[model samples]
Target: MMGSRGTSAVLSRAARMRQKLQSSLEASALDIEDVSYQHAGHAAVKDNANETHFNIKVISPKFEGQSLVKRHRMVYDLLTDELNSGLHAISIVAKTPTESGS
Candidate 1:
């Protein structure tokens, strides 16, 4: 029973978190997709009805010289507020211009 207050709250929270990351990092490229709807009714979702999963693709010079784990950590730190609050899992794909062949 994913009521209005259940999923929407997390979705809104996620959107705001993404917005903050985008603005703060001024990322060269950033993509945030709301895949929560797709996970609904799925086995893994299990009626969590919260911001439990995400696939983030970020390309920024800020990531230069940073290892994959460090880059992801940077992104996580930016959204620490949300992650600590309720955001569960985040799948990050961070890259720099050189690494991305850009």
Candidate 2:
């Protein structure tokens, strides 16, 4: 799968990053899904499948005391390598269970 280039690859990358964050932050709930097809054939779509476009839904107690920006910053910091590697855009919905309507 190292050479694969498609939504699956993107999802895989996201899962890998989620695993990294889980280890680092001891998250309570983490769900990472790929939404590349929603933007497929759009102006932002890249010829290279590795190009980034993701919608992430994360629920974690780590964000309990942190502001939205701070929580996003933590995720961004953790995914710096992925960002540099190819990820261009991430649509993040971060919440605690209470805030998530759960």
Residue 74, model 1: lDDT of 90
Steric clash count of candidate 1: 0
* lDDT, candidate 2, 1-102, per-residue tens: 365345445566777778767877666677776766666676655684653677777787778889989989988888898887767778777788778766
**Alpha-carbon lDDT, every model:** 0.75, 0.74
What TM-score, computed on C-alpha atoms, does each candidate reach? 0.71, 0.71
Per candidate, the number of residue pairs that clash is 0, 0
The Cα error of candidate 2 at residue 48, in Å, is: 3.1
lDDT of 2: 0.74
In model 2, the runs with Cα more than 4 Å from the true position are 1-11, 41-45
10 residues in a row with least lDDT, candidate 1? 38-47
lDDT of 1 at 76: 91
| Model 2: how far residue 6 lies from native, Å | 22
Tens-place lDDT per residue, model 1, 1-102, is 898557645567667766777877777778776566656665655556656567788888888888888988898989888777656667788998778887
